[model samples]
Every structure is written in C-alpha cells, then in structure tokens.
Target: MAQRDYAMSGADARRAVETGLAAAEWYHTDIPRKEMKALMARADQPAIRDTGLLFGCMALFAGLGIALWPSWGSAPFWLAYGVLYGSAMDSRWHECGHGTAFRTRWMNDWLYQIASFCMVRNPVQWRWSHARHHTDTIIVGRDPEIQAMRPPALGRIALNFLGLLDAWQGWTKMLRNAAGRLDPDEADYVPEHEAPRLIRVARIWVAIYAATIALALATSSLLPLMVIGLPRLYGAWHHVMTGLLQHAGLADNVTDHRLNTRTVYMNPVSRFIYWNMNYHIEHHMFPMVPFHALPRLHDRIRADLPAPSPSILAAYREVLPILWRQLRNEEHFLTRALPPTARPYRAELHRHAPGVPAE
Candidate 1:
C-alpha cells in the first residue's frame, strides 16, 4: 500500500470513502436479545462506588502528600495521587463521556466535566471526537483518534509516558480553542455549533491553570501545582501504558475489530484504574455496556472472540514485536485469530483490507 495518509482531509480520506471503508458497517458477534439487554442495562450503584473510590484515594493520597511535603517521605503518596489524577481520570473521562458509567445522566455529565478537566480535554470537543472515534475507528485518514499512525512517532510515544509531548499539544490546543479557533483536524470531527461551548470550557481551564500557577509563584513552592497540574505529567504512565495497547500494532483500515483490537487480562489494580478497558475488543463492539458489566460481557462473548492475552506483560510481548516490525515495514500489523466458535469475518469487507497479508 502507499504510505498511509492519516489526515482527515487528505487524499487517503478520499480513498477511504472511495474504497468503502469510511463509516462502513462493522461486524458484531451474535448475542441473544435478552442477554444483550441485560448486559447493556445501566445502573448508578457501581459507578457511584467506583467514582467514590477513585476520588477518595486521590484525596487520601493528596492529604498525606501535603502533610509530609518537602520530604522524600511524601514521594510515594504523590506518586499514587498522580496515577489517580493522571491515569484514572483518563478512564473516567472515557466512560462518563460514553454515558455508560452511570444510569443517571446528570451524574455522567458531572463526572465527564470533572474528568475532562483533569485530562485537559475539552468536554464538548472530546464528546464529539470520541463519537467519531467509535464511528470510524482506525480507518486511516478518517479516524482522528488513531493513536499509532503509520510509521508511528516512536519518540512522541515515549514522551507521552511523562505527558510532555501530549501536554504541550494539549496546552497549545487549549490555548487555540480559548482564542476561539478550532484546529483543522479538530474541526473535521467537532461540530461548528459546539465551538462556543468548547471555547468557553477552554477559557475556564486557562483561568484555573493560571490561578494554580499564580498560587505556586505566590507561595514559592511546587506544592500548589502538585495538587493541580503536575500530576498529569508525572502520573501519566499507567494510562499511557494501557491506552496504547487498545489498537497499537493492530490492523488499521479494517472493519473487523478482531483484526484491530486486543483484550488483555490485567492485575486488579490496573483493571480498576483503567476501568476494565483491557477488554478492548468488547468495549469497541459494545460501547454502551457499562464498565462494571464488561467482565460479564466478556464471559458472555468470549467464545466468539479471540482469546485474551493472559496478562498485560503477555500483551506487551505480543504487541511490542509487531510495533517494532511496523517501524520497518510501516504496513506490518498483527492479525488475531478468532476461535472456531466465532463467526467468520465479514467476507466482502475483510477480503479487501489494505496492506493485510494473506492468512
């Protein structure tokens, strides 16, 4: 295949539509209506409990960090706080934005707002952005959210662990939005009507960050920022680790999620912090399912799915080589084998997957 064009308004965008890949109907595993209905059912209790735990830990850790500041003794507490703030909030922003975390709309909206702020994402822009992500996942030139674009920027991915590159981009985008201009890529997916709201939120975020920086300057200490902004940098590792595995090294421009996603079993703590998103395939297939119900959903649907990686490390073992290979081939990607119980991939679409090697 020609070198991939990942830009939404580029030649590949036209090619994606011409090839019938953009907004194409995707394959889904079969499930009984009753069972699927139950799986999709929403509730408040689980999200309420999880949100409480998430923020509760943040409070406890931040409290201890503050109480023991200016000492190495406080480092662990701040580290823990950073993961919760930096990593945990990413999942919270995702689930709440999907409106699957809570049955109550207001609760989802409230948490989405808070989590979006923590993520340095514009709630209005990201809501639309994520909607487009679901609509055209991994379709090169169509999916604005494809993380590991062809000839992936290996260095940028490395810097993301420290939130440096992403923070710079995020801050720049926030400022641009605050100045009432949507970046070209952002405008491709974000609605013009929503621009005002996104701009307003960006202004609000600028005010908050400015105040936090002023407080840091006034006190001549990094403590204020530790509570407000620095965690997004220092504590971003876990989320970056989990988030990359969602589609990294997997097939792009394919309709079958089986070819494009991974589901890795993770430790309870990582699963909790990542909100069970390690069930990546299932989440993509059933975006309406609440995070609490994902394990059950996985059990219900696993027979038709490819086997999940036994652990996060196992997934890394599987993904790292593919990514390394892709750096050389650019078009190289992993092709997951579905179990015999699974329905065959949609033949017409799978037959034409660009750059995918023959099985």
Candidate 2:
C-alpha cells in the first residue's frame, strides 16, 4: 500500500487493530525473513551528519559551566542538566540507535559505547530495545518499550532514575533474552552476530564506569564521583520525562503504526535540537530514514496524516485526561485502536478473562 493510502485507512481505530493483528500473526507465526529483509533494505540509507552533536556538547558544557563556575555554583545545575544537557545526550543516543554516528558499523558501536558510557547508558540494551520498538510500535504484548502499564510503578522504577536504572534494567532484559528465557517472538531485536559485540561493549562500559569512579576518588576533594557523576543520572531522568511525555498516553488504546504514535508541535529551535523526532508518526512509518531526513519525509506526507492534534501543547493537554486514569490503573490504557471494518466492535475482551468488560 502507498504510505498515503496506509495513512487514511490507518486513521480509523478499528482498521489499525485489524492491520496490526494481521501483521503480527504473519510476522510471529511464520517469520518472513525475505520480505522483512527487503523491507528493511528499502529504508536503509547512508549514515547522515549529526548536527545535534555540536549542540549536545554545548549543552553539556553550559551545564558544567553553571555547576563549576564560582559565581554560578548554586544555579541548580541538575535542572540545567536535565532540561538541556540531558536531551542533548538523548539526541546523541537517538542518532546512535540508527547506526548513524559514524561510517563503519564497528566505529559507530564504539562511539555509542563511549558516548553512552559517559552519558551513563548502555548502548547495547538501548539498541536492542529501540530496534524492537521500531519493529513493534505500540503493539501491546509486543512492544517492550510501550508504556504498557498504569500506576506506572514499573515505568517509575525503570525509567525515572536518570535512565541509569532503565539502562540497567535493559541490560538485565538483554541477559534474559540471551539465556533463552524470553520468547523468541518477544526477544525484540537481538541478532546472532550482534551478540559478541554487545557483550564486549558491555564490558567496556563496566570498565569505563569503574575508571571514572576511581579517578573521581583519587583526584577531587568534592567527591566528584557523587556530585559530577550524579549529573548523568539527572540527564537520564530528563530523557525519560521527555520520551514518555512524547508518546506514552496518546492512543485510546494500543493498535499499530499510525494510531500508536502522535506528532507534536515543535519550534524551529527544538526541531533543530531534537533532530525532528517530534514527527513521531512519520518516523514510525519510515523507521530507516535517519533523523536528518525526517523533516523532509514529514513535509512530503503532512497532508496525508490524520490532522495533527491542534498543537503540541494541545496534544499534551489531550493526553492529560487519560494520564491520571492510566496512572490509576493499567486497564484504562491497555485498550487497542480498532479497524474500521471491526467497528460495530465491542471493546476487546481479554482472552484470559471471561465475563469481564473491557476497560
């Protein structure tokens, strides 16, 4: 189907359900390696420049300046780090996830491991989970990254602690996946060849962490390990907040492709800094396109998308009505968007539950 045609029928909630369910069954029951290979290849393009790197570095420098400059010492360095330096780091990792950090694949992996180590994130776990997110956007029981539960204790524990814990949990998840504890279908994005590299990169990350701590203890009087080191955790929290706010509660229910992700209004500055990731829907549809190309793709397809929720601000407001509900109970947010053909549809009854109404 044309991307445009996909967008139209895709706007109907029921159409989304049918389409996603069908695709999931096909992909899961009889994996179409050839077709998938072809599909993924079609979207593959050369690595693009990361314009965000300079800005990210600047943000990091600015935050550090605020923290260390004598006159600026009490300037709430963590806040500056969170809103600015943190998102800057996110942009870096975001590009790394796409394998766009450098020309060689190995080079890119190393860059991500080093940069991610400094940022206190695990590139291997992030790459795996993020790739899975692309493969299964918003498909409940499928997308491990999707905000699956309400009262978000899981998200809170996993995501809130400056992504250190989130990254840590991701590593733990990766270990289980490697051990064959997780279903192959649910394994997300690990590949046989990538395993060795991930293990090595993980070891490098451990060494970097230890060296950083040891250096902090030996060199600085202020316990640089605790003070400066904690900023990366602050950065992780910023990542979690912005990331969750961007996509968490947009849909009435999880379905697939179109309804699962939403676009937000972004100012030019943000567009430049965030590298156009705010065009969430288009990126989901065209996952292989690098961050730099997203704006062009979005422009080409703008008229085809469901009208954007009035503005990013308005869109955020729209999610609020459901946020507390989601926080109160998972069921409230666990519904799926339905396909047009399936309307006259009843709320999806959980196969596991009998005589129970869908929330």
Candidate 3:
C-alpha cells in the first residue's frame, strides 16, 4: 500500500477531487417515501425525555461526588459524571449538529452549543465539518473527521483516550479562530461568511474556560476545573472507544456505507450515552432520520445492509487487530462481509480505485 497524505491540503485531497471522489454520490438503502418521511420526522417528546434523564443523572452524580469530595468514595460518582459530561456530549453535539435530534430548531441549536462546549468542539466549525464528513464519509482527503488515518498515528490515538491530543488541537484551533484567522484546512470547509461567527464563538469559549480556571484558582480547589474542564479529559474514553469503531479499519473513498462504516449492537446504557449512534450504517445511510428513530430505521434497512457487529466487544475483536496491522500496512482494512440476505456490495464501483481493493 502506498502511503497517502490524509491532510485536506495534501495530495490525496487533490486526487480525490480530480478523480471525482469528493462529494460523489453515496449508496443509500431505498425505503418507501411514506416510511422514510416518518423516520425522518423529528419530535420534541423523545429528545425532551432523554435530555431530562441525562441531566438528572448528571446532577445526581455531580451532587454525590461533590458531597464526598477529597475521598476515594467520590471516585465512582465522579466517573459517572465524567462520562456524561465528557463522553456523552460527543454524541449530543453530533446529533444536534445534524439538526435532527429535536423537532424544534432552537432546541437543537441550544444543545449543539452546550454539547460542543462540553466536548471542546467549535460548534460553528464542526457543523460544517460534520456536514462534509457525511457528504464525504471516509474519503481520506475529503473527510476531516477520519478518526484514524492510515499507518495509524498510534501514539496520538493512545493519548486521545485521555482527550489530550484532541483537546490540545481543539484549544489551539480555538485560539486561532478567536484571533480571527482560520487555518487553511478549516477555511476549506467552513464558509467565508461564517468566519465572523466562528471567531465570536471561539472567543466566548476561551472566556468561559478562562473563567473556570480563575474560579479554580480562587477557590484553591480542583472542584471548578473538575466540573467544567477536566471531565472532558477524564470521561473521554467511552466516546473515543465507541467512536473509533465507527470507521477506524473500514474502507475509505468508497461510495457504500456498508463498506466504510460499522454498525455495532450496543447495550442500552451505551446506546443512551452514544445517542444510538451504534446504528452507524443506518445513520450514515439515512442521516436525516432522527437518532430516536435509528432502531426502526435499522430494522427497515437491515436486509439491505451488512449485519451489525453483535456487540461493542465483538466490534473491537475485529477492529483492533486490523488497526495493529494497518500500522505496518496502510492498505490493510476490514471488508465487512454482508449476509446473503443483504444486498451485494458495490464492488464494481471501486474495482479500479487505488488502495480500495475488492473483497
């Protein structure tokens, strides 16, 4: 496998455009119009109920942790709080950024902003970034959100478990945005008109973070930082764990989601934290469908898609080794075998493509 640059400004990005891969049409499972409409329909009730429960749990965990502060007994409560505040917010930012999480526009916007802050993502920049992600799925140069680039940066991936690399890059970008200068790659996806708003948002985020740090210093305690800033580091493991399963070892520059995405069946608790994104292929195929409706959408398209991994453990069992091999072989990737009941992969479409070998 030839080493290809995954940077937006790199050769692969240019090749993608020249080869007509960037923004190319993607494969989708067809559904009846009425059924698709129903699936895409947004409702406030489900999001409201889920949001209430999420916040309620966060509050309970935080209260317990704070009351038992400076003790080992607080560890469990803080751990729960960290997962909710740090890890769970990643999914919330994602779904709400799609504007499909809630029927109400303001509700989605509000949560998107809040969750973006929790995850240390710039809401404005990430909105367009994710739009590009869906539009270009796993196309190396075109997709900004490819979690693990080939010849995997294993050290960065390891540090990202604690949110170190991600946070460092995010804060650096935030500072750059606050200075009203967009990095070239970011400028590629984020519109020129949105630049001002991105700057303003970044400035606000910097202020809030500064305030949190100041409060922590003033109190001579870690409570404030733990509440606001540190959870993103401590609680990031779960989301990173689930998120890497999304596209880590999958084929890239392919039109088919079944080839580039994994759908893992996760437990109910994981489902809640991940906002049901484990139905990843379903979400990618029909991104308009609300998160609450993904399970139903999965059922509707199950016969047309690759069989989902039975569990998170099952997914890792397959992905981890592929990732390790990819360290030595950039072309090494998992070709998800589809059930006979599922539609055949679009092998002919990618037969001549470099780096994307047919299974």
Tens digits of per-residue lDDT for model 2 on 1-359? 11111221233323544545423421111215654343334222333334344446556755575457544463465455444444555666676677744445775555565456555445665677677567656544434565433434554645555656655555554455444354343333566666666566656655555676787768754344433345556656545544654556544233333444676667765655465678777667666555656666666555545445556567656665566665554444323344343322223422211111224
Ranked by TM-score, top first: 1, 3, 2
What's each prediction's TM-score?
Answer: 0.97, 0.65, 0.97
Winner by lDDT between candidate 2 and candidate 1: 1
lDDT of each: 0.89, 0.51, 0.89
TM-score of candidate 1 on Cα atoms, chains taken together: 0.97
Provide the lowest-lDDT 10-residue window in model 2.
1-10
The parts of candidate 2 lying over 4 Å away from their true place are 1-56, 59-85, 100-111, 154-189, 220-229, 252-255, 310-312, 327-359
Q: Report the C-alpha lDDT of model 1 over 8-88, residue by residue, as the tens digit.
A: 899989988998888888889888899999999999999999999998999999999999998999999999999999899
Give candidate 3's error at residue 273 in angstroms.
0.1
TM-score of 3: 0.97
Tens digits of per-residue lDDT for model 3, 1-359:
45878789898899889988888888877788999999999899999999999999999999999899979999999999999998999999999999999999999999999999999899999999999999989887889999888878889888998999898888899999999899999999999999999999999999999999999899999998878989999999999999999988888878888988999999999999999999999999889999999999999889888778999999888888888888777887878778888778876646424453423
Please identify model 1 stretches exceeding 4 Å from their true place: 356-359
Better candidate number, 2 or 3, judged by TM-score: 3
